[model samples]
Target: MSVTAQTGQRDGTDRRAGADDGREAIARRLITGSVKRSYEPIVDLDWDSAPVPGRYFLPPGALSLVGTELWNQMTVEQRIELSRQEMANILSVGIWFENLLNRTLLARLMSADPAAAATHYALTEMGDECRHMVMFGRAIEWSGARPYRMVLADRIVMTLLPHVLRGSLLWVAALIGEEIFDALQREMLEDPELQPLISRLMQVHVAEEARHIGFARDGIMRRKPIRGRWETFVAGHGHALAGVMLRRLFTNPAMYRRAGLDGRATARSARANPHFQDAQVRGFASLAAFLEEAGLMSRVARYGWRRGGFLR
Candidate 1:
């Protein structure tokens, strides 16, 4: 090879090495921060204290039927119960996503450099996820709400879209699971009207999720880009559909039945409710913009985002 060609190749290699070193430094920092701030949710949260009466588990505006005529007909007690149920449902989705993330993290470790700080951080993050899942289940128990189950269609779609949690899309899915909910819960955490127990729960989850989001976003920005239009299309659409389904999993049909509402009717109303759609658009706005700017979004992904109420 010509001397100039060799020199250019060497420069490229050095730049890549520098980038990897920077990422390792970030992971090492995260590892240290995690050790300092990680909470043992079982002891950190007061599990034995009963929920306060006349307080909301989540904000009124966060509920699916908040502004609808149907919501207006419900008694204040019913509305509070509905909020509790929805919070439980949110926890259910959180558990599912975090559990999936643990599995994905372990899988990633198989081919990763075992001694790398990034690999060690992935292990540390999995510990955080385990505690989050336990916290979620315990919080649902505290609210006296059963764990929400995903709808059949959402389950089927997840079964079909394996790629959503592989390649660059894995980090995208992680961000989807963590960021939107974290953003929405920030509003919940600040509200004094929130139930005391729930206030603590949100604080713990949100604090840790911030770290997890950083990890995912860093991975996405650094991962190898997908090649070819077909591969990009598959990644975009598959991820888009997966994201839509993830949102759907937040509302369990059984939650409505337990709250004394007709499950099907309420589900339909919630799906069409302008308030719910607006909340989704608002809550997801930042995450969607970030992914799009990262070039992770495609034309089909944009359509899916709109359909999912994640974008205007």
Candidate 2:
């Protein structure tokens, strides 16, 4: 996309200042939505009947290894087992991401005016994330799957990116994490072949994440006016890299090892799988659309997004 096309978004010129009150109204509506729809996983989920046999913990198609040659060789039981471990790892990584999100939000809140409605909504989102972390932890325990930790490189990248790309990329990255998971979970919740426990967990998550994504998208729009050319370049590439990183986090080699596959080889196959890449393209469609509309998808950034498999 050209610079002219980027500036053409929602009427051509920078509109951040005029969008402030509108952003606040959106935030207020999100708070109301959260109050009405927020869920308690412990009280709401059935703890005794988890891991119900003959059902997948995630939809088969959502698995990174699915449709690859290695996955074709797995027995029904092996497939289901891998799904359980993969889902656990995804949830565990979610917990890690949520911790970062909470801290980032609190740090931003410190400078934000306390009386603003956006600050109140940020607090509400922090509370929702706290509940989600506990919910993910319990699900991991009940499903008998172990949590997966970030690799050293992943940890280092995650730690530094927030500081390096504070305004635009930071918010866009958070939005991607929430929306990509929400997109997959929406499908899982409706999949009859999945366990009821997994479906219910997704139900609660998807319900609340709609509001979170809204706030993040709104934030990006508001920040567009202040971001200069260099800042836009940095944010664009950073957002692309962040999307790829989040996708990698979901497909752990440890999951393959636990499921009795050759971890390294299976991970390699998953990375090369055309079906998996297509799933990523589909999963990230909404996010890509948002970036384009928000005037964040510059020509240089589009290169990184294409390299990252988030665009193309």
- Candidate No. with top TM-score: 1
User: Which residue runs of candidate 1 sit more than 4 Å off their true CA positions?
Assistant: 1-8, 151-164, 224-235
Question: Candidate 1, residue 163: CA error in Å?
Answer: 6.8
Tens-place lDDT digits, model 1, residues 181-290? 89888877878778988889889988988998998888667644323465555556656675466446654567788889888778877877888888888778888887
Error of 2 at 244 (Å): 3.6
The CA lDDT at 89 in model 2 is 90
Give Cα-based local distance difference scores for all models.
0.81, 0.80
Task: Report the error of model 1 at residue 284, Å.
Answer: 0.9
Sum up the clashes in candidate 2: 0
How close to the true structure is residue 117 of candidate 2, measured as C-alpha lDDT? 86
Task: Determine which window of 10 residues in candidate 2 has minimal summed lDDT.
Answer: 9-18
- List, in order, the clash count of every candidate structure: 0, 0
